[model samples]
Target: MLVINALLRGGIPFIIMGGIALLLNYQEKYSDAKSTFFASLIVFFVGAATVIYNIDHWSLTKQSVVHFLIMLITVYPILLLSGWFTIASVFDALKVFLVFVLVGVILWIVMFILAKVFSW
Candidate 1:
């Protein structure tokens, strides 16, 4: 199925990245079971969410907007749970949102250029 394929493609990387993040943040204190559980949950949603791209009728902009929103909605909470940031005020949340959006835009541009260059 397309859904399964999408999950496998995106979910695997998502889970892998979770592991990498755990390793990278070695100095931080994270309960192994809790972290693994959260990582699995996050990866499952992220991977499953990628199936939105298969909606051929949707414009690229629409698909992208939906996907970006899904990522932001899903990933941000998990990042917070993982102790990545402590937001004490609305400004903190806005700062994080802006940074996330900025990084997403930069990555999108890079990928667009790479796709054009490779004729993808």
Candidate 2:
């Protein structure tokens, strides 16, 4: 069936990338990985339905919207799996990353002040 083919066309890559990421960096402790994978699955169902219903007809020059949607479907699962597999929960990881950013900014400011004070 055409529908099944289209679903697979988008799904195979999503599953491969998601599965690989899950294997490589997956944390069995936190629920983030499972949640992300499930969310992506939901998105796939919705997106597939939208595609089947002829609702994705947005023009962008020569770029095919269907292809763009397929890419998103393919990429987001991998991204979620990779991004959420850390030991920390996704929220905690974001907070930790933010703290590091702040620390870097503070160091940069201190260096800038010292450079100005030393005229170098």
Over 1-120, each residue of candidate 1 has an lDDT whose tens digit, in order, gives 877787797678767766766775684655664566576666777677767767889997998899898878887667666644678888877777777678778977887688689975
> In model 2, what lDDT does residue 9 have?
53
Query: Model 2: per-residue lDDT, tens digit, 21-101?
Result: 476445563455565565556445544533443333545322334543554455344444454445357786565455544
Candidate 2 residue pairs in clash (backbone atoms < 3 Å): none
The C-alpha lDDT values of all candidates are: 0.73, 0.52
Candidate 1 stretches greater than 4 Å from native: 14-51
* Candidate no. 1 TM-score: 0.67
Best by lDDT: 1
lDDT for model 2 comes to 0.52
